[model samples]
Target: METNMTLYHGSNIDFEKISLDKAKDKRDFGRGFYTTTIREQAKEWAEILNYRSRRDGCFLYEFTFEKTDNLHIKSFNGITEEWLNFIVENRLKGGVQHSFDVVIGPVANDRTVNTIGLYLSGDYFLDEALRRLEYFKLNDQVSLHTEKALSYLKFIRKYTWTA
Candidate 1:
């Protein structure tokens, strides 16, 4: 499939009321604006977040990567020792500091959440965690990790949730 620069961020709140400043810490790839190439995954995220916020449906916000220049970027092609470590680091309570302005890779979804939790809690080592994650096909995501990267994300449009 042809990848578009356009990406989407889903939330339970309405578009107008959405605020980037309100984002909390201890998130995947740190507290930053996260978008994905897969719309279905965004929908799934919306539905999941909506359940907790008591929002009616998901709000899809579109954005574009404006600066694809010599910007600092990192891409993990697939599940690997390094990829699993990166995800584990970012999701940990203290959080990991990364040099990349943007990081692109698979998401740690519901299926892998517990395994990640196990790894974080010292229940599973790297190899064991990765072995478990390999069972489920992961989805791709792009996360803008710095203000410099976030500045390049230009909002394109908003779509209502009906799916």
Candidate 2:
């Protein structure tokens, strides 16, 4: 099942860059068009995550271990819930949706296990959403990818004005 969450931002922006002149051209049929806006956003998010990772120095990794160790004991757990709430509250506003699946497994040493998951979310503005999600994998560093997707969704949310 696909889960949807909306991130609310307070303004509108032009996210669709395809020109009618170009779109109407018969030769353009089946030809793929590209947009760099989301790419830029993803880059921004990646940088943020990278910086945090560098500073935390395996904090994310350790958190994963802790969560796995106490999986059965549920009650306002560790960074997982904190991360989820952070993403949901801050990143996921203005009609932007984020969906992700949790994964747990063993790391280098057989004695210890690692727990991590991919957070999948994107905007409705472009066709690249599903492509991006499909390309992502567990343990893959995709802060930028997710960020760009979210940015695009924010772009879409802005134009879908109801007021």
Q: Give the per-residue lDDT digits (tens) of candidate 1, residues 1-103.
A: 2233778888777755334476667676776667897777777778888888776777888777664765688889888888887776777743436888888
Q: For candidate 1, report its TM-score.
A: 0.84
lDDT by residue (1-163, candidate 2, tens digit) is 2223222211122234323233211110111111222333333333454465453211111001112222221122222333333333423242212232122111111111111112333333123422332333322111111222323222232222111
List per-candidate RMSD values in Å.
Answer: 3.1, 19.6
- Sliding window of 10 residues with minimal summed lDDT for model 1: 15-24
Per-prediction TM-score to the true structure, in the order listed: 0.84, 0.18
The 10 consecutive residues of candidate 2 with the worst lDDT sum are 57-66
